[model samples]
Target: MPHTDTPPSGHATDLALLLTLSTLWGASYTFIRIGVETIPPLTFIAARTLIAATLLLLWMRSRNVRMPRDRRVWMRFGVQALLNSVVPFTLIAWAERSVGASLATILNSTSPVMVFVATAFITRHEPVSLRKLIGVIAGFVGTCLVIGPSALDGLGGQLVPQLAIVAATACYAGAAIYGRSFKGLHPAAPATGSLLVGALVLTPASLLVDHPWALQPSVRSLMALVALAAFSTALAFAIYFRLIQTLGAIGTTAQAYLRVPIGVAIGVVFLGESLPSSAWIGLASVVVGVAAMSMPGSAIQVRRV
Candidate 1:
């Protein structure tokens, strides 16, 4: 899956895995929509993280992966939990409640642009270039298009939700930058560690704020929650980290451009939602922008080892 100048056959297989990852992840929004109907948002998120954390812990134990004994590394894991899991997980769930899955995933595609912008400020050594800036502008325009004209129906009413999605993207960007600290840790160790922290932080909040014990979720919703936990959270991370290792970050993020279509497909097929023509246009713009930002040699000098 590593990116190569000569273009190996693994490129094709990596593309296939990326497509599959997008499909699985895109379907998550629908599952969230269905599951949230029966479970409170906080409860749903907390439960999913807990289940995923438990599974990851068990897997790590089976693999003989030792937890980081250093408090600094554990603190880094906590930061990762916040930026990667807690904040974005809550924001996207909240946004999905209002914007629906297709649009939400489109919004999520803005991560690359967000990362570019963040890198401009966060890493002084790697400033944003004019081309990257154009991609950022195009990504925002595409986001606006996806939201459609009716987005302004109320006086600044749509601002919060739109901003929430943006905040989610910011969280992802921050996670990507912050996760550089974990480059030394085994992938599963950090992955499991952060999920544990996420569960610890979120569970008490879910209990105190939502009181999920008092309200019962339907069986269908429970199943959806389990699927989201097992497939979307745990399995997705497994595949994602593997892809990141095998293909590198740029190559893995190339898959972001593909997520929009798969998101739309799952939204239409399962949720019976249709997108506006403008949304499709927006998606096209996003694809172009992401492709620009992710082009080999545009930023990183990735090499297959």
Candidate 2:
């Protein structure tokens, strides 16, 4: 299929979608942090996927869109689940059990960098441009700045959990690239299917390990889980898969940086947190990086196999 969003207004719409995606996913860390306080990682993520899948399924039905029935498509959905939801979600949830959300956010925000590395050395999905290279570096530096110095204080430490977050980031990169194939389907198809597979994969494990029936979760944790499932996973996945088609993997993954500055700004505006002087500089860098990434010239044509 050809790229759909090519006009100037389309670019604006795509950027707005990127911002919405960033905002939804940016708040996910806090939701996960709160949900995991009482809900075990496996159960937390299993429930998240299940709830999200159900919501997406309903949305599709409302739109009269039927999911694909092919076994091959379902198989690909299984792989996507592992890359995008099952493993990464569980790893981040488990890692957050021991690490702070800020650190995890900074670490996982490297999706664009990872995608670029894969594009350079592994996937070779697109050409390596100096503009994009600079964008990746600038965005990463800005992410670090927006996250503040305190978050990096634990960089070298917490080796295991930190590695988990890095691993999750890599999975996200892989998922973004793989998601390109689903462009043939409605965005909701892959999102719902993958989450369905993820829920199926994790539900049994969650039951065996967490024995959720016996646990008493706090109301706060339950609320957090609901928000994480509905907005972060369901709504965010819809936006993500759509962008994967319109923006290509590397371009869509620019949200990895955009979210940090935006998230920090949210705190300043709504949560009464003070924005440091460095955050202003970080915001400027992030805007430049995202613009470089999403420029019409950067759109890639996939070499279909």
Candidate 3:
């Protein structure tokens, strides 16, 4: 496949999809935080995947889209599900036990940086250039500034949870790269299949560990779980696969850069949270970095000797 150093043009629809995805996923942090307060991580993740799988499967059936019968394809979907949904969801849910939603959102925004590094070093699926390198660096620095130094007060003690979030983001990057294999398949097919696999794996674990049947979850937590599954997992996957097909892995993962600001705004309005002046400045830097990274190489001029 021919590679473009940056995202392709004429992507108004893709850009809209990116924003929609960012909003859906940005709100997920809040949902996860709320749900995890009452629901154990494994149980919460299992419920999320099962609900999302049910919704997506119903949509696929309504659309008359036939499920792929190939066993090999299903196997691939299993891998994608583990990386994209199961692992990351559980890790983030667990991490939220010790971290605030806004902090977790800022940390998880590292997904784009992970995607760039994995593409450049491990997969070699895209060309690595100075522009992208600088963009990634700027985005990371901006994220740090957004979180501010005070957020790091517990860094030494909460290292484990923080590392879990970082690992989860890395899994997301890997899943984005691996997901390109499903390009020829309908977006809904893989989305539904992956969720199904995720649910299958998580159900047993949740039963054994959390024994969700015995616990009494609050109505608020239940509603949060529903929203997380329906919007963040099901609908988000559909948009995600479409973006991967149109934007490729690196471009698709760029939504993470946008998620930080959106997540913070959602927190402020809905959760009565507040951000410092530095966060606004950092958000501006993130926007500039993402814009620079998304531009085509030809759009940036160089003088020849």
Candidate 4:
């Protein structure tokens, strides 16, 4: 199904939307931090996908958009769920148990770089240029700085959790590349379908491992879970679709870097978390790199929906 939105008012409105989307996504790390404190990662992510998927279905229904019934498209959605939601969502939830939201913000902000690497080397689905190459190098150096000696100190400890966040970022990159397969889909379709698939994949494992029925989650955790699913996952997808149409793919990607500072600020203000000086420097590098990668005419715009 398809429909048209009234033309956006102007750049200011677009900017507001950009900020809103960033704020919503930025707050997600903190939500995960709070929720996972009481809810086990598996059960928490399962519930998240369940809530988000249901909301996305309602969103689609409101838009008069019907999900694809093709079995093959659904199978593709299953693979997308594995990459976009199931694995990465679980990894981030598990990682946040030890890693702070600020670090996760910086570490997870490198998806464009990851997407570029995958596209350039493996897929070659898009052209590469000097500017984007520079962006890649800058992001790589920043990622190494964020992950290497100063932060790691050793192989174990926070290092494994940090690496897990990076791995989750990689999974998102893979999802972006594969998402192009749904080129003709209503934006709501892939989002709703993938989330539904994610819920299906995670629910059984969560039941077996966590036995959520026996868990006693606090009010703060439960509220955080609701916020995480409603605002961060579901509402963010709605905003993403709006931006994709109004701002074009490249313009919407500005959120990639913008959310870094926003996420860090949210962590500090709400969660009382802080990052080391080296991580700060790495964060700056990542912001610059992502901005460079997100510039006009990059040919690597990755639409999350």
Best by TM-score: 2
How high is the CA lDDT of each candidate model?
A: 0.69, 0.88, 0.82, 0.74
Across 1-305, the per-residue lDDT of candidate 1 in tens digits comes to: 21111123265566576667766676777778889888988889999889998898788778776677899889988998998889888887777677744456556766766666556655532434565556566655665565564544542455687688778877876666565556545666667788889999999999999988799789999999999998888877656655555444434554555666666656567769777678888878766665554443454432212
User: What is candidate 2's CA lDDT for residue 213?
Assistant: 99
lDDT value, residue 46 of candidate 1 = 92
lDDT of 3: 0.82
lDDT (Cα, 0-100) at 279 in candidate 3:
92
- Judged by lDDT against the true structure, how good is candidate 2? 0.88
Worst 10 residues of 1 by lDDT: 1-10
Misplaced by over 4 Å in model 4 are 1-19, 136-156, 239-256, 267-288, 298-305
Clashing pairs in 4: none
TM-score of each: 0.78, 0.93, 0.90, 0.79
lDDT of 1: 0.69
Backbone steric clashes in candidate 4, count: 0
lDDT of 2 by residue, 1-305 (tens): 32223223378889999999999999998899999989998999999999999999999888787888999999999999999999999999999988887788889989999898888778786666767878888898888887788888888788999999999999999999999888668788888999999999999999888899999999999999999999999999988998888888888999999988777877888889887668888888888998878777744433333
Record all residue pairs in model 1 with backbone atoms less than 3 Å apart, i.e. clashing.
none
Question: Candidate 2, which ten residues in sequence have the lowest lDDT sum?
Answer: 1-10
Q: Per-prediction count of colliding residue pairs? A: 0, 0, 0, 0
lDDT of 3 by residue, 1-305 (tens): 22212233357778788889988987888788889878999999999999999999998778777778899999999999989999999999999899765567667878878888777767777656667667777776777677675766666468889889989998998998998988678788888999999999999999999889999998999999999999999999988987887777877877787777787777688879788779978888877776656655533322222
Deviation of model 2 at 53, angstroms: 0.2
